[model samples]
Target: MLTIKEIAERANVSRTTVSRVLNNSGYVSGEARERVMKVIEETGYVPSENAKSLRTKKTRVIGAILPKISTETSSRLVKGMDDILAKEGYQILLANSNLKPEKEIEYVRLLKSRHVDGIILSATNINSGLTGEIKRLNMPFVAVGQHIPELASVIFDDYQAARDMASLFIKKGHKRIAFIGVDEKDRAVGHCRKLGYVDAMEEHQLPIEEGWVQKGEFNMESGYHCMKAILEESKTMPTGLLAVTDRLAIGAMQYLKGQGLSVPKDMAVAGMGASELSRFITPSLTTIDFSVEDAGREAARLLLGYINGESYHEKPQVVHHRLLERESI
Candidate 1:
């Protein structure tokens, strides 16, 4: 195993210089810092975890809990969080709750037991007593992709994104639209998206039948069943559909195809999320491009702030989203 001594020797610098550079001490010169870093990389010098722990009195570990990680949204969020945390010598202990609130609470307890410095959470909504949970544990935490009053969060502008997608359908002459939302408590996938649809319908002087809106589990299978049943029971066929997430849109599209119905020509479709799967699907999916990566980075920043006793005082941030128009809509 390579050591700091060997790295310092190879870099032709004192061990103190290498240590200073590794610690990001302000006194090191840029030239010396670059050389030490280069030598450290070239020699594959693995720093001792015990040494790091002793020096910092921290594990440099972050606990991350999410409802489900198989979705593209969560994957992108992890990528973004990694982009920042990796450079700071932090590793994340990731846990999946499989959409169960109890599992999330259990994971929080486990992370606290392990003495992790901070936590990042992604779920439908902030756990109602999440702040109290953290207070009991005496640990710092930040909510991501969801919001709670009086807590730090790295959230996006879900209302605006949902509003934009619905407004686009309305501007394109779609009146009588159906909205299939994801989680009931998901402000982004449910409340915000539905609110956006209603606002657009009212703006266009169209009647939004209460029957036209429903909820889905943000999965292909659930979307297929919901859309199929919705179409079967409808008084009239809708000209536009707004699926709350990309996976739901894909499943809904499959049902439409099975019925020999084509997109836009029959029922125009617009959905949220630009998951990689959307691009290859037949007719392509018209959707919103949200920044999960930005959410991840923001989450890390907030958690790091909390760990350092720094005040990250601000309401949840609403990152930007854009409409990605494709053949589906």
Candidate 2:
């Protein structure tokens, strides 16, 4: 119902002065600022964000692209990002990719088109094409969950996390260990974690059976079926199992329950991601706490620094993981 002109007139200040005060750009005397604030408060005036963007060249909004928004991991990360950004007068414009890799790239372009100040991509994987686009966009960007050498990112130590999980079982004297992982397309969660498991197994002189390793999608059903296949095909039963994610681990536990196999006593189990279900499941689960929320907060903080022309170190910021020893192992 009101415009900047009317507010300026009521405050007895030039419209240019009002604009400066509203944008917090040019210097305004304390008296002028107070008068403008009083008039704005009295009139219930709200500045047009579009007009302000045109004047200040800042939308003060960040775009966050995630693969699946409904998951516990994504939800926690978004909350952490929101917590930091909100304090700095910024908000998030979320774009969900529904776990499609191509959609991740598309959302980056779409967010740029919307004139977002920066983008925080919860990257599922990395290739030349995606990296090229990030470079081409030449925008303030940070990748979460996956590490790219060319861009800044906030990532978990997936390899170490997986290795540590395997070591937990090994230290408990598990010789034959089973593994359930997702497609290698997700390099961080699928490939690196598998490599870590393999590394730990080899380090402990444990022989890996051909049928002991199973690959599945990042879901519980996949875990359930994969565990079944392992049970059916493996010549000898595995003493321990390491799944790439908490969902997969939980599914494996369900399968074990159905099969009347006692966890830790019969087959120790562990997973990454530290999902809330890990703590409540029967016998609980040994897992690696990746501190996903911290990753999100750091991603937002780094992206904002880049957008604001501030220096930040640790291009691929590494968030440490903790081993949660539970009844599962």
Candidate 3:
């Protein structure tokens, strides 16, 4: 372990000069900085983040709380955030809530306790408990995927994205359309998306059967069951289907295959979230490209703005989405 004093002595510079060069703060002559850098490179000296934080009150670490770490959406978001944060000499500390709302609040306090420079929450649902805790913390924060009131957020146009998909189906002459969604507690995917579908159908004067709508969890198995229920319970069969997630749509397709039905011929299907599986699946899947990575990058930039003393605003930065028309539809 080479101390700053030792490095300064070897470089023929004062310890203060070495400190200034290491911190990239204060002014140091180019010659003196070059000398210090040469000695540090020779000795492989790395500055202590703890010591730097104690002096500057910044850890250079951002805490990211995610709903689920294993999903592709989470990975893409992380990649985007890291792309920006790493360039600015910051690193991410990840906390996975495993889709538990209680864990989200718990991690907020835990991250605050750790004295993170800022927090980025990839929120699934914005509840009062989580929002209240965040407000009390009074730290630099940004929410992604869901908009939080009075806070900076990077959100997707979930409602319009769903509406566009339903319109596409209707344009292709799909009158009897079925919807598979998750719990309405997940307002963005479950509620807004379902509402969009219903509105599009109603606007076109299409009749919706009692069994045309089914609720499921965020998994393929749930989607399979939902599709099965729609088939068994609906008196009039639907010619088109829309699912809130690619996994659910894939599950529904699996059920349709088992029943000896062909896609786009027997039933045209579409899903949200342009996942990799959606591209490779048989006949491919028509889905929404939400550009999740872009959302992550935007969230990081917003948090950094707050951390850097930028003015706070309640307006959310909404990311754009596009529909990928594939063979399924």
TM-score of each: 0.87, 0.95, 0.98
Index of the highest-TM-score prediction: 3
- lDDT of the candidates, in the order given: 0.82, 0.90, 0.94
C-alpha lDDT (0 to 100) for residue 238 of candidate 2: 96
lDDT of 2 at 166: 90
> Which sections of candidate 3 miss by over 4 Å?
none
- Tens-place lDDT per residue, model 1, 207-247, is 87655776788688988987897797778788888988888
The sequence of per-residue lDDT tens digits that candidate 2 reaches over residues 23-128 is 7888999999999999989988888888878876999999999989999999999999998999988989999999887898899899999999999999888878
1-329 per-residue lDDT for model 3 (tens digits) = 89999999999999999999998999999999999999999999999989999998999999999989999999999999998999989999999999899999999999999999999999889899999999999999999999898999899998899999999999999999999998899888988999999899989999989999999988899989999999999999999999999999999999999999999799999999999999999989999999999998998898899999997769889999999999999
Candidate 1 Cα deviation (angstroms), residue 39? 12
How far in Å is the alpha carbon of 110 misplaced in model 1? 1.1
| Superposition TM-score, candidate 3 onto the true structure | 0.98
Model 2 stretches astray by more than 4 angstroms: 25-30, 310-314
By TM-score, rank the candidates, best first: 3, 2, 1
Model with the higher lDDT, candidate 1 or 3:
3
